[model samples]
Target chain A: MHADYLWTAAPLIVSAPMAKVAMPKLAAAVSKAGGLGFIAAGYHSDHLEDLLQEAEDLLQEGTAETPIKVEEGTPKFLPVGVGFITWSASLEKALPSFSRYCPAAVWLFAPPQGFRDLIPWATRIREATACRTKIWVQVGSVSDAVEVVEAIDPDVIVVQGLDAGGHSLARGASIISLVPEIKDKLQELRPFPQKQIDVFAAGGISDSRGVAAAVALGAHGCVLGTRFLASPESLVAHGYQKALLDASDGGTSTVRTKIYDKVRDIHGWPEGYDGRGLINRTFIDHLNGLSEVKNREMYREELKRGDEGYGVNGRLTTYAGTGVGLIREVIPAGDIVKSLREGARALLYGPHNVSKL
Target chain B: MHADYLWTAAPLIVSAPMAKVAMPKLAAAVSKAGGLGFIAAGYHSDHLEDLLQEAEDLLQEGTAETPIKVEEGTPKFLPVGVGFITWSASLEKALPSFSRYCPAAVWLFAPPQGFRDLIPWATRIREATACRTKIWVQVGSVSDAVEVVEAIDPDVIVVQGLDAGGHSLARGASIISLVPEIKDKLQELRPFPQKQIDVFAAGGISDSRGVAAAVALGAHGCVLGTRFLASPESLVAHGYQKALLDASDGGTSTVRTKIYDKVRDIHGWPEGYDGRGLINRTFIDHLNGLSEVKNREMYREELKRGDEGYGVNGRLTTYAGTGVGLIREVIPAGDIVKSLREGARALLYGPHNVSKL
Candidate 1:
């Protein structure tokens, strides 16, 4: 079946499941606006039930209309998806939640044993949910996409480039090249007239222009992390939001490094994966040969400052992609999705459309 | 004037002036196929007259139907453009050729003193060509585009991202983010109803999908470097072509480094600029702690082997972007341009167009 059947939107827009940041409100708001929203289950399953329940309650309250397309006779499941840092999250711990609330999809990323490690998680989740939930795997390099597809035959593949925020392969091309390459390779492997696997472009995408561009790059949809960070529904601190707003040339202002994870003592990320964030004192100090212990101490001090600790001078981590510069102000999550969809539609199909070649 | 007036194509396509590789034949072939083409002037003015003369002869012979549109009352000038490695190519040495041929455009890149260094070169070229030659400046960052625009008010700005092959800023985002960011910033500076500066995307663009994506990302056009390398008209060696064809997953097989320049003894590139090329024993050996002298010695030995020296195991450089994996065959440059144009047209305007959002 065409993977687009899983979503109701024409150009599927997805809010990335940024750990601790993407929560029930953000997830539900996106789904309410005709896009897919995901909750970051993170490395622990302790809070997944509560998050899903909150999303369910929000959906039931009918605060906003949802556009999620549920197949006839399908079992009850949350419209929102759940993501995990597969390297640190245990499948056993997450299986209970998967059995309870079969999210529309399960996004697996950064497995320690490479894509093969995701096979078990995908299989168990399928079994637990009776295949109700779709399997989505994120990959940076084409090899990873190939490997993952061969192993799990995932329903969706999110091709994330090096310009992405949080963690990704340290070495990978951008979506301009990566998306089409992966799409072509997958098409060759599966050929046409087979069960088509949907491809979503992620990283460095902040607005409608990016969504339209990703669609032109042969992606069926787009996953946005940094853009959603500017939404009120996201569980981001005020200071972090301000930093993202104040940031202007993110290509230079942001960098990919393990310093944020190191200072936070989050060491379980597999090799070749590093987080992209604003270049601040923590990173500068690390570059200047400051000891890890001293950096950590400063970071702890900044953390106590609450909203004040996440600017250019602040030591707190402000995870963002290179597209952070495009984010101007905080808006409602539903508005972000609606605006992107309308803007992309105009740009792609308007009278002045330049994409007509 | 809108930059589209400078060429005759819809969804304007341009062949990148890859030094030593992009010759008159390739440039003329692209122009013949209804797109703009550029001849790389390299770092010297010695053979410019001969190159321009040969391109003129080719156009006259009409081996291919020329589609380059010439404006009424425009001074006699070659339809193709010329590019310079601004840091090393002296304006005085190149002015004679510029005055004689009065090329359609002059593309400037990698000036040592930054974009300001291009001021004199642009001024003199305009003076020599009586302001007929359009100016195109290549930049890798948003700041650089802003700086160059403020300095020269170029007719076109080529936004080269980090995924580009050949020399470019070592630190920059991919075109997925860079193109629209530059486009927005330039619009903010120039506003609407002002002389609109056309923005073209360069980097990791191999096929029609990339062109469509660039247009969707707000770029007025696209510049293809690696894709053209697979064309028969490119000055690439047989071994280099073979390696490019054999290469898959270019994001992992290629790397950006100054080691190629270091080994070749071509050190004129300014700070923050580096070249991306296929990784081989030369780079591997250097990574393994091989001394510069030892690496150079091995490079010299490999150079003697001619075409045999350019492969995964060989030490010779094969400059290509991250889209190398998509280039499978060596076709005629005209065919490449036509195919890309038609394919992009189909993808962007076909009945199955998914970019409609």
Candidate 2:
């Protein structure tokens, strides 16, 4: 089943699973647009199962009364997937019920808990469905990627560069440089047959040009998070969305930082993890020499100023990529997929078309 | 004259003017391989005229004695170019004698000295030869790129990403993401009669994969550095070359850092500039809790252990890219260019060829 899907069902665009941002509506919208869409299973430690169940039910809500027999190799949900912070303590408890949601595939990120532990999760998913549920592991460093291929054998290895949002590897390589390196390493591992691992690029990719670049850089596909952050279906509040749109004029507006994480009272990311986002009030204040403890105390009160307890309104964290400058509007998720597909097709052709470029 | 060169003389590969590393032989070899090649005019404050004279004479040395009356758009020195740390204290001294070199183009990096200041330098070149000697300004930020286009009106804009070796922008965006954003902004500036500025991607680009990716990301061309560090023509020391080869495996052997600058006794890098180099013994020692001053003291001694009192011995720096892991051998510069050009061609075509990928 996995072989069939990997061979035929690959899509040109895939929406990254964003915690709190990627919900059922966004995932379904993207999936419906012939792109893989995923719900990020993060932060909702105890209620993850319930959230997954809700998302799956919402995805299948419009199915025909007499379910048509699904074709082999073709996706039942088209492109619905689930992503996880694999290092989260909640993963062990959340693992057993994942098969119930019937995700087309699972994207596991930041497995600092070690690559071997991922074996049990992969085994469980494969065994539970009695069908091949694809396993994709994200590795920040090439060593970890090698370990994944040798130990667990993931269908896809995401080479996460230093320029990503939310939780990024503390010291990661640039995506374009890292992808080909990883591909070469994987080839050396399985010489004859050649390790058939698809490499997906993430970090600083926000537009059709980046997508096309990924394919050209020997990646099977690319995942976008910050670009989708401003899509209508994303849970980003109005204030954060405005900050994103305002930065579209071109400047050093966003940066990779650990400041927001400290102010948000979020704690305990495994060693070597940082976040990227629009440089907000808190970051500037901290850079200006405000103490971390004092900044945290001030942010606690400032958080109450906004409608929700999160945003760029006061000292809130606005997770985004450096490519946020390119995002100008909050359109539907499906429309983003369509525009990206069309734009990439237009730019990626030969000289006759690229001359205008 | 500028339009003719930009149109007819476009090449598939180009060697960047790397400080200290790029020499007469390396530049000439790259140009002979159908790629633009450049000599870096670095730290030659007193003998600026003499060095340019030597480089120019050397570049034209092997030319046909019956000089074929160079065509209008044809390069006088073929593909020979000269680069400068534009903000250097020596640029004023270097500027007056640049025409002597008869360069195809001048690559100016890190103009923190302000974009407007670059105009007189550009005007001087045009006046020197009564022809538009194309001016190229390196920018780390979009605003600087816009400034260069609108004010200085450089014929080419090199997007130097954060992953590049040697001196780079303080807080720059990734190359892939920045290229498209700058392109969009330039389009808005000259909407109808489109601004025909070409984008060149630099930083972390090693093999043909990076070149293909750059073109797909809207770059007219790409520049390579670390990959060429191992090229026999490169002037890098034996110790540095060996360290580069040993690190050609999957590991975090390189990083973007500033520690090297301090240890090397190099000073006065305008506020935000740093470097990307191999994580050598010095990096490991400092990480193990040595004080910054003590680390510097140790590096000073370790430096003297090598042939030229430099290298990866104990506390020396090996300036390179995050893709240093991809460089394995010390081949000829022409072979490196050939392989990169061929590899990029194969990967950049449509699905008919990429299916095996």
Instruction: Name the candidate that leads on TM-score.
Output: 1
For each candidate in the order shown, give its overall lDDT on alpha carbons. 0.85, 0.71
TM-score of 1: 0.96
Q: What's the CA RMSD for each of the models?
A: 2.3, 3.8
Where does candidate 1 clash, by residue pair?
none
Report the Cα lDDT for residue B18, model 2. 86
Which stretches in model 2 have alpha-carbon errors above 4 Å?
A1-11, A61-79, A193-195, A249-251, A307-313, A349-357, B1-11, B61-78, B192-195, B249-251, B288-293, B307-313, B350-352, B355-357
- Model 2, range A1-357, lDDT digits (tens) per residue? 224343122335678878878876787777666566787776544666676566655555543322312223322333467787777746567655554555667888766567887877777766665545578888888888888987788888888877677788766677878888898888888777544677888888888888778777778877888888888888878877777777752326666678888887777777778888777678888989999999999888876677454434456788777788788888888788877866665656635434343
Chain B only, TM-score of each candidate: 0.95, 0.87
Q: Considering summed lDDT, which 10 consecutive residues are worst modelled in model 2 chain B?
A: B65-74
Per-residue lDDT of B1-357 in model 1, one digit per residue for the tens?
A: 324344457777899989999889998888878778899997866788899878877765554354454332334578888899888887888888877777888899888888999999889888888887889999988899889988988988999988888888887799888888888898789776366678889999999999888888888788999999999899999999999999988788889999999999987788888899999999999999999998999999899999999989999988889999889999998888888877877777878776544
List the candidates' TM-scores in order: 0.96, 0.90
lDDT string for model 2 (B286-343, tens) is: 7787778998888777766774443344566788877778787899987887788767
> For each predicted model, how many residue pairs clash, with residues at least 3 apart or on different chains?
0, 0
